[model samples]
Target: MKDEIVVITGANSGIGKAAAIKFAAEGYTVIMACRNLELSRETQKEIIAVSNNDQVKLMELDTASFASIRTFCSAFKSQYDKLDILIHNAAYMNHGEKYRLSPDNIELTFATNVFGPYLITTLLLDDLKKSKNPRILHACSNIIKHFFDPKRKIDFDQLQGQKKDSKRHSVYKNYCASKMALLMVTFKMADVYQNDGVKVNALQINGAKMSKATLRKVKPHWRIIARIQNLYFPSPSVMAQHYFDICTSDKFETITGKLIDHKQKMMQQPPSHNPNVITQIKQITGSKVYPAYAANPEIQEKLWELCNSLTNKNMVTPSSEQHA
Candidate 1:
């Protein structure tokens, strides 16, 4: 375990920071990939002091930007020969009512929450494969199951939150859509890399207490509600234990392509299992949803193609070949 390497995005604070400390204490070399280098450096110092593990390092990464994702992958590959785990922990939620675009000209929330991880994971496949036990974990939300609209399919055409749809969708709606999309990708990757020994899974840290930094990002009203809710919720450290368990536990060694709840229990498959629903989602957003993607190889290929085209990187072959 002392020689294993782990990379966690958005590790400057919140659960990401907590997870990094947990892994470091266990003797893994933890790399903290974050957008803000200064904050990450401070957090790195804190982790080193607490865990007494100086193997923690920081790397610049902004998941919202395609160029930044590519650049970070290149830098990481150059420095590290093997990656045992990759945690897609960075997420964005806008409090403003208006829609915003990332530097890549995609919806801000979707870019960070979905496409960013999509690109980064695909690009780093080779690095991850070098490890004897490779694992990829996506940080998702339980709200996806609650807020997902069964009636409304993913609008690939309006991924950027067009002005015409502003009346119909709110900021929260966009956030849910992004998370649902990510869940789809999570299932798809789990199947795609199953044979290659890379375990892929998503976990929702439901009802976890938010750090002060995270709370500041919440809307004023939501922050008040969150404060009230935090009284009964577990701390981020407690919630992070679930993450550490899934990554290192022998019980989960064969558990690939499943969404785990906050309690570290496997979530039941979504009610909708229609392949057409997955097809419709892929046709628009370039990804499938839930159980459908878990079984359909054709749909998975289409999603990989779309993601490749969007990022301008053919990191994965269309023929289901795993990169070593």
Candidate 2:
């Protein structure tokens, strides 16, 4: 484990921080790639104090910004020749908020939750390829079931607010769509790099207690519900153990292109209830729909192309930076 290196996005708090601690305790070199350097430094100290492993370090990275991603990768390449594990754990969900754009002018949620991970992976692919057993883990949500519902279709034209339809601008819905996109990227990359000895997989994350910073951002109306979830759901530490397993456990060493839960069971899709209200609404509205985007090879290919174009369009040349 001492020789292994792992980079976890958003590792300052929540499941990311917990995962960082677990990896540090195991003597792995844990790099906490976080948007907030101040918070991350504090967390770095905490992890070192708790795990007694000074290998835990902090790196600034705002996944929503392409420039930051490029800079982070360049600095990482300068310091480490190889990356053993990469965890796409950072996510942005603005419940009850207006649509926002990222630094690259893409939909903010999709930029951070989808495009950022894809771009970072590409930028660091060579480092991952150098590892004997490189693994990339994507954090996903059950909300993707909305996209999988038979009646709902992922309108390619409407992605990233291209359609500009206010009716389709719901933040929560866009978040779900982004998660679905990420799952598609996971499967596609798994196929693309299977022969290259790089394993790519997604985790179907279950409910976990939200951190105070996250709780503060929750809408007032949803606060009570969020609190209730925190009370009954598993803690971040519990969920982090699952992440650790997928990265280090031999059981997952050979697994790729699959969605696995905390119990280590492979999932085809997130569980959905029998009475699908979303399906009923679409039927009543007579809305034109497409099949599930995750399983559709055509949609997956188009998505891959779209992401490539977006990242390239906003490309920034990476240059080495002195470590802080």
Candidate 3:
């Protein structure tokens, strides 16, 4: 019997590493795809020692770079015949950094948090399809609520870094926008790949304890706030267990296009109110409103096309490649 193969991006630390350990312990072939080989090498040792299963492998993958993504896919294809599970766990966020771009000149946050997962899933679709019950889990953030608020709309210019805002927490703003875009993409992908027997779902990450490295990058005042929040946040191990349960349980085998929270409950978008009419609703109910994009398909398609346009011939979509 062949062991199921699982690939987790950004598996060097935090939840990714913890998930790797959990999967390895289950006797699966866990591939730790990450940007930092040095950190990953250390993590590989820990995963092996802790799991007592030596099938953990390390490969370089910089989700922020399109070229790196392509290389990683090619390398993976040469060695592995199938991918049973893919966890898009790698994310890039900065507390107070100025605007940045990937090597492909896309907005860094979108490139990593949204575009990277889209490209990886597209590239690895065939490998995933080879498995009888393949699955793709996107590690999504609940911070998307901020971007999906009634006051906000999808900013096409900002998504590709063509426009910059003078907002104080522009980086955090980018992070939220990217997360919202990711959910849109995840639902779109669930529809696109439905016929191929690929199950795509987004995991809505609640507050999780922050790593020291992540904490160090925060501004001093915010670091204090983060510490206070950390006291209430679930540990990474608890979150990793959730990842394991979702992957291994048959209950999720057919569940697609859903946003699942840490408590294993489905998250539905709040009933959308017109931004203009939000005040009316509030006045009528005297309760706060959670207005969102409704996971609008038209907007999702436009964003999908924009992301596809940014890629070259090698990164064509599955449907397009089919016609070609």
TM-score each candidate.
0.85, 0.89, 0.89
lDDT tens digits by residue: candidate 3, 46-153: 899999988999999999988788888878887888999999999998777787888888888889998888888889999999998999988987676565445777
Off by over 4 Å in 1: 147-149, 164-169, 270-305, 313-324
Question: Which pairs, if any, clash in model 1?
Answer: none
| Of 1 and 3, the candidate ranking higher by TM-score | 3
List model 2 lDDT by residue over 194-266, tens digit each: 9989999988776789988889989999898999988888989987898999988999999999877667677
Which of 2 and 3 is the better model by TM-score? 2
Runs with alpha carbons beyond 4 Å of true place in candidate 2: 160-168, 269-292, 313-316, 321-324
TM-score quality measure for candidate 1: 0.85
Best by TM-score: 2
What residue pairs are clashing in model 3?
Answer: none
Quick one: ranking by TM-score, best first? Answer: 2, 3, 1
Overall local distance difference test of candidate 3? 0.81
Candidate 3 wrong stretches, greater than 4 Å: 164-169, 272-291, 316-324
